[model samples]
Target: MLTITDLSLQRGGVWLLQAVSLTVQPGQRVAIVGANGAGKSSLFQLLLGQLTPEQGSVALPGGCRIAHMAQEVKASDRSARDFVLDGDLDLRRMEAELADAEARGDDHAQARIHGELDIHEAWSASRRAETLLRGLGFSDYDIGRPVSAFSGGWRIRLNLAQALMRPSDLLLLDEPTNHLDLDACLWLENWLRRYPGTLLFISHDRDFMDRGATHLVHFDQQKLELYTGNYTAFEGQRSERLAQQQAGFERQQARIAEIQRFIDRFKAKATKARQAQSRVKALERMERIAPAHIDSPFSFEFPLSEKVSNPLLSIRNGQAGHGTAPILTGINLTLLPGSRIGLLGPNGAGKSTLMDGLRGEKTLLAGDRTCGEHLAIGYFAQHQLESLDLDASPFLHLQRLSPKASEQSIRNFLGGFDFHGDEALSAIRSFSGGEKARVALAIIAWQRPNLLLLDEPTNHLDLEMRQALTMALQNFEGAIVVVSHDRHLLRNTVDEFWLVNDGRVQEYEGDLEDYERWLADRRKDDTEAPRNNQVTSNGVPAEASAGEGVGESADDRKARKRAEAALRQKLSPYRKRQTGLEKEMDGLQQTLQTLEADLANPALYDADGQARLKELLGKQAEAKSRMEDIEAEWLEVSETVESLEAELAG
Candidate 1:
């Protein structure tokens, strides 16, 4: 449980929060949302005790353990798994005590420490850390790698894994999905749903918030408003509220004008002077209602290219990779004037490789890539942000791109990205990540390219800018291929999906939901077997054999069948447990749905219904906690079943 009373915070003499108060009950997942520099992260800092509020108080239950994902990780030679395991301070402390006891030859203390470790289930700590890392897109090989070996983005993922590893009753995550791919994002959603604690996170990902958040804490006008439902529900409620506010504002304005007109018309007459003075006091006492304001600062569309080609780009029999060895082979792709494709695959797959090959950055080893005579490409990627000139303004950046373009036209274009006047001309060295990303996008948009290749273009963008980009992409009259974790953007912008996996590129004949299921099945299969290329003992390709018993003796085949049957018998209990957990989860989900519907009634939020509201909230939290337990049990049992199946097959 967490509570803030009359919280007021200021930074650089600017108020970020003014008289904001919120109470978050235990087992509630809250999504903190606002524009950039709107105090979302500042609130997190206040909770973490990194910053003190100028006034008011923040309270947490006594001795409650808190865990938060760090935005940065210091470079070190410690193994990644070790770094994650270190998050469990209790386990680490116990280990240290055990070592000391052993050095002193105190058998009694050593035995006591061993018992404590067993009670804490500390034996499985390493495996748990590994699971967290794998869910965040790290390969098994990466577990033993040093922290210093990972890039900045991967290090951020390491921080997330470390945060997840800690045992706590409160978890805080800020932009946890920023560095993750689609697979990792889905995995994290499931993980967070099963976190039986108070969850407070800030994310610009709409889909993520909808799936994970049970409550939304909105920051607007230096005030915090708590909504009892997910982002979609919050949107509906906010729309109604804004509409009512606007209407009230209009009515109030009309009444004030009427009062003022009467006062002006009668102020000179001696007989009506007293009445006019009374009207003036009434006008001054009237509380002015502020009009509702909701408008995005960004508005821009991709300009059409001057020249057009039927087939803008084509690649035939392409083999793309880092060096001599190819990661993706037999890739035949063609892009036309209106082609729009989204790439889908697991992490470390060939999606980026394919993008590089299509963009002509990676030379095809065994095939030819052809381009139209008038081909023009606009490519956007995270690394491109680093390529920007930090010393130059956004206007200057565009001007350098088109040396002959007029300054007025460039400024007008920059205005669409919310870079106005002095800000447009200021050097970008001190700009935030989102600002730099916008400048990169502005340059790409100004090129008027016929083809666009974007890879994770919305990494640092806020929700408003992401919506703007989605709108722009919808109206673009050019071929586009994008690789992004933002499902909303992919679903809205791309017309087709291409799957790049296992050294092959092919069209995926399914929607995003179907692709999600496909990924789940693939992960299940991967857990049953190694991902390395399958080969026989003699180094022959496994798939090259046509018959089932081509190289097996009758005794060996019978033995294998017997072993499989025994393994199935051994796995029956785990399968049963898994089934029971799933059933319990389904029942809890139904209960939660009913409770949410009941809570949606506007009457429950009124002044006379406080008791019922609190009661329903408590029930909701209880049901969610139960669901979390069931899901965790199900995951453990499912993993056991898969492992047994793998052993039987072997």
Candidate 2:
């Protein structure tokens, strides 16, 4: 357990965190959220005792240990295994002392050393160290590799493992998932979901917070508000709170108006002078909150480019590879201008290979590929960011990347991405993964390419940046082919998906969630299908089939067939309700858009129109409430159906 009482911190004469007080109890997951630099990291540092507050105190329970994983980690000239093993420095040293004493034939010294060694050899300590190392994605080979040889991302992971290895009662993690790939992030999510220790993590990963967090601690407007739920639940609660706050303020304003009217009518007559004075005093004493400013979603409209011919990029049975092995084969695909296509599959499902082919980097095995005339393309790779020189500062990196841009323009561009002041001068090597990703994005934006190929582009971007990028891409007139695992981002940004599987690509209409649901259904067939089908159980079949009845049994007329049919019938309504709910949500969104446009019109300033707008806002709230209820019902129904179906199939 840890408590902060009257905590305040200042940097560069500006109060970053002031008079913040909160208690973090054992077995609680607290998410520290704020606008980019609302002192989330500084608060974590204060709790970790790395930084002392300018005022107040941090009180920890007696004998409570704390561990912290900061956003950035420096790679040193040491093997990754050695770096993690170094977490037990005291134990290792003690063991060495014991070995030395035993070889010296000094019985008295050996007796003392044995007691020290016994304390260091605790089973809990070893188990925790092993768990931390493995949870952070260090295999046997990785454990032995020198830290110097590892990429900056791997070094960050190693540092995280080392910090977590400490026997800490409370863990403070700052943006822990920024450097992690999909596989490692999933492992970490599962691990943290069941972790017993108190966790106070600062992250921009909405999905991770939705799964791992039990409480949300929002630091905003020089105050902290605690919400008792995960991110989605917290979002709903925050919306309600803001609405109530606004309503209360409006009521107060109306009361003040009434007081003003009464004072104006009576005060001049001297019959209600005292009342007028009292009303004035009351107005002075009212501790009103400044009207809350809700951030509207980022608005973006890309400058439209001239229309180009169809088949922006054509791969006619293209064959692409590296060295003697082929990464992709028989890849016949065509990209069209203005298409927002999401490339889906696992990490090495040949998405990048196809991108390389489109970029015309490798030899096509036996087919022709063509690029449209006047096609200006931009390509982004997850590893491509590493090519930036670490020694260069952020400003220098940008200046070097685009020499034509003036210093003021470069600074302005960096500021748009939330990099300003000293941050712009910070060494590229010192930047967090999120910062680097922003730089990569800035580079892409500067080029103003007509076609964009992005691989895992959302990996290290913060929520706000992701939303901004989505807005930018949504408005861009050029074509975009993106490979990403972020379902939320992909769903919001992409118009369609190019499902890459089994050396071929299939087009699917709709958002990334559609692709995910389709994949989930396909995965169910692995165990249900014949052994010769070569389908894997994890949902990624060796070869994809185009149909809704992927894993459905072809023959089922047996003793349990009656039961199966009954289950299906029971599930049919829920499935139908789910479908109807999805359709209703779509229609509601369109209506909301129309109402929002009307409200934004300057002519709607009349009192009657304002009231009408307010009523529409209330309807929007009601629609949101209904949507949540429907989604919850659908989830419960689906879960029940799946459980029964799994049992019957077994």
Candidate 3:
């Protein structure tokens, strides 16, 4: 068991935790959740003995082995596999002793060491390390690469693998999914589920928290509150408690108001003077309950484009790659107004390539690319943050984009993203990763583009900011194509998913759950394939024979092309209708969400607010009914489209 008692911690003269207490039992997976700078990482540092608390005690089991995933890894020339294997300190120690014994020509010591190695199963250490690497999205070829060969993101993944390589009684992971793609995130989730140790992780990924967390440690108001379930359960329970607290606060206020009124009316009268004094004393002695405050600091929306064209962008027979080598080929895609697409694939399967192709970044090695006259693209990627002017303030960043815009307007917009006062005018060089990401997003939103291509936009964002982004995306009228590992964002924001796999891009017919199962099947197939058959980034065998139509006759090829065009013509109306229905449903859902939020206001239950409440309730019901009708139509249209596509394939 891990225990913390009276943990009062302060940093830079600011209290992060005050009298925080938590007890975690063995093998419990606890997810620590809070806003950035809420001391979630500080608590981890305390547990790791890197920081001393101002006043507190932390207890761990005697001789407990702790494994922590480092936030950064120093560049090294060491091979990736060797670096991971080094995580197992005991295994390395045993091997070192055996080597020393062998060098000393001590036969008895060598034999004893060999027996210990056998008992420890040290022979399989390399294989186990390789397994960890593979599960974390490293290819067989990458296993032998030097640690310095990988980029910053991939290096973080290696660190995660190293952490997993170590045997531990307690494991600490901070934002483990931040650098991982969806497939690797799923793999890590599965690994954590089977880990026979106490797990304490800090993550903003909701789906990951739901899947792996058996409990939650919430940091709020300088206190750590433990909940006995997953993140979803914590949300539900917290909502209930907040509602109750709000009600109690309202009641207490009403009672206090009544007492104040009594004191005002009877304080001059001798008969009631004693009673008024007693009542004043009672009011002062009454413990006040703080009103529930759950508002997110970040609140912003993508500005609507003044002009948008149908089929804002299109690529025909496109081959996206670097220089002359294609990473993704045979790509045909169209982005229309109101289009919302989420790209799904394994790491390095060219999701970013496709995004770049759409962004007109010279990634198209072959084929025709066209953009509408009114098409305005707002492209956001991780590298964009690096391109930001580090010395400029957020205010300066926006002002540079629009020289004519007034300072007040820019400040107002920045305020929506929680950048206010001095922070807005401060140089971005001192900002954290999350703050920089917010700036990048703010820049994109300031442009008011008709189309958005966001790749991993939520990387360093906290949960509240992520929720804000999701809401903004939902309300956005422009087209969006995003590549993100955040399933919650993908599910709530995108109407369709595109699978960028096997060197081709196609619409994914199922939801995120089905995509997960597809990945599992692909991983299983990869494992079962022959060792000598190297797999490409798209999971295709590198030595595969030939293209499907390699030997086709000219006439047959022409006929096939004609048939494909005919099928597309036939499917066009259904596809358009499906898209239209999805847009309608999205609008109605937004309306319903607005109504729900209004209804959730505490004032809505008051006597004076009954009329407004009734109106909101009616609006909610009507929107929900419209949503149901649209959903039914959407299902029918989707099924018809699927049937037509299946018929064409057959």
User: What would the per-residue lDDT of candidate 3 be over residues 1-650, giving only the tens digit for each residue?
Assistant: 99999889999999999988889999799999987898999998988999999998999988678899998998898889889988888789988997798799886676566545544546456767788888888986687678999999999999998888887888999999999988899988888887878899999998899999999999998999999998877876775676565655675475456445534543555643444454455345332311222456877899977988888999999999887779998888888887788899988799998888888887889988999999998988888899999999999999999999999999999999999999999999999999999999999899999999999999999988987787678678899899998987776566678899988899887778888899888774224211112234674444432333578898997787567556655664686588678657756765776787678788989999999999998888888888889999999999998887787555
The better-scoring model by lDDT among 1 and 2 is 1
What value does the lDDT take at residue 285 in candidate 1? 39
| Order of models, best TM-score first | 1, 3, 2
> Measured by TM-score, how close is model 2 to the native structure?
0.60
Writing each residue's lDDT as its tens digit, candidate 2 over 1-650 gives 77888878876687887787888778899887777667888787777677877888999877566777745556676656456656655556765775687688776675555444333333234345545655555654455456777777677787787766554567788888776654456556766775557899987777778878999898877677888988666666665556566664674465446445533543464643443454454344322311222342223333444556576888777677675467677777777766677787544457777777788876344568787886777888778778977888778877887788799988877777767888888888977766788777777776667788887787767666765675566556678888765554554445556767676767754443354455446432112111112233553333432322445664543434455445544554454465556556555665666767666766558775787777877887887787787778768876875676576445
After superposition, which runs of candidate 1 have C-alpha atoms over 4 Å from their true positions? 244-293, 524-650
Where in model 3 is the C-alpha error above 4 Å?
A: 244-293, 525-650
TM-score of candidate 1 versus the correct structure, residues matched by position: 0.74
Per-model lDDT:
0.81, 0.65, 0.81
Candidate 2: regions farther than 4 A off: 70-78, 88-94, 97-101, 104-141, 241-293, 296-298, 344-353, 362-367, 381-443, 446-448, 476-478, 495-650
Output the worst ten-in-a-row residue range by lDDT, candidate 1.
525-534
Reference-based TM-score of each model = 0.74, 0.60, 0.74
> What lDDT, from 0 to 1, does candidate 1 have?
0.81
lDDT of 1 by residue, 1-650 (tens): 89999999999999999998999999899999888999998888988899999999999987678889999999999989899999888789998997798799886676566655544556457768888888889987687779999999999999998988887888999999999999999988878887867899999998899899999999999999999988766766765676565665574475456545544653655643444454465346332311222456887888979998889999998899986779888989899987888999999888888888888875467688999988899999898888999999999999888999998999999999999999999999999999999999999899999999999989999987987797678678889999999987876566678998888989887777788888788663123211112245674444433435677998997786556555655665575577567657756876898899889888999999999999999999999999888888888898998898678545
The true-versus-predicted C-alpha distance at residue 471 of model 2, in Å, is: 3.0
